[model samples]
Target: MRKPCWFLAPPVSRAARWRGRCCTGGWRVRALVRDPFSAGAAALAARGAELVVGTFEDRAAMRSAMAGVDGVFSVQPSSPGGTVTDEQEVRYGITIADLAVECG
Candidate 1:
């Protein structure tokens, strides 16, 4: 099977709030965000999507968490990954691209 399409990478705080129990699925239906830990999986549990979350930036941890996952959704940190490379401008573009592909 092909790699699973990663959908969203909403912050842990946001995903924890609107997980499951939707209100006509307005913003809730925009796309799923996969955060570290069980946040993403918990959020998607009620939506019929098997999303898995964990501290995958840790290689071993990421591998373990993504063992069965088909794809990943991620964004580099604004400072280290973004500021270091001074590519903060590309952050939004990357996010949009990821969203588009995941939504498709």
Candidate 2:
């Protein structure tokens, strides 16, 4: 059987969880990132994850990235110096959920 596709959004925490998923050799991980050239993104790519270039703020991008995903793992940064506002975070989370429903 073919592996299910999992879309991971905003892979913070050094993407440890994402790396674990990649190493498990079951699901096909599709990680979203603003910069595909970034070190973290490169690491994920090295671990067999397919990189999708975009931010959570872009609904179109998110939807596009989630086109064939069977599951989604989204995380929002909560650093005191983070730029995203609380309302934006909520909106992005909702957007991801909505997209998952729409895609599924």
Candidate 3:
């Protein structure tokens, strides 16, 4: 069976590389993003990622995205600005990890 991979808030650079790998049948890639219509998300989809519309804080979305996932690559925002504080970022990361464990 093909290994399924999930990418959380994947940046363009890493997404691009992963997309290439997925195209070559390396593994199945599911990209989780807040906005699926965004240009970056569109690009990832165009390259072969199965887009999972979601945010770090959305538990339902995270759970749905992580179902049957073999591995996960979380890429959260670096600067905790705009409504998100450092503590919130940590919480979001923990939430993702927790959901991964729960789903697995």
Candidate 4:
């Protein structure tokens, strides 16, 4: 039987941990990354993750990333640094959850 495919979103370190565990368990790991060429993404690729280049705000990309995956592991960015607003974080979380249900 084929093992399941998992779609993962970052903070890279956490996703990398999950990726490691999943890869070790013989499951396919797919990662959603804003920049595929970034060092973190490259590290993930080297560790056997399939990188899906996109941001959480991009619904089309999110859908594409989620396609055919058996599970999704996502972490919405917190707004402590003002990089992402509270509302935006909520929206992103809702969008990802909605897309996961829709994709499934």
TM-score of each: 0.32, 0.82, 0.81, 0.86
Ordered list by lDDT, greatest first:
4, 3, 2, 1
What TM-score number comes out for model 1? 0.32
Candidate 4 per-residue lDDT over residues 5-25, each given as its tens digit: 646456544555666777667
List model 1 lDDT by residue over 1-104, tens digit each: 34333334445544334334331233223233345245555546555554444331333333343344444444443455443354543654464454444444
Error of 4 at 80 (Å): 0.8
- Comparison by TM-score, 1 against 2, better one: 2
Clash numbers, per candidate: 2, 0, 0, 0
- Candidate 3 on 1-104: residue-level lDDT in tens? 47678867545555466556664676778888778889988877886778888778789988988899888877666564576678877888888888889998
Model 4 — which ten-residue stretch has the worst lDDT? 1-10
How many clashing pairs does model 2 include?
A: 0
C-alpha lDDT of all candidate models, in order: 0.42, 0.73, 0.76, 0.77
lDDT of 4: 0.77
lDDT tens digits, residue span 8-91, model 2: 545557657766665466777777878999888888888777777887777788888788766777776544557877887788
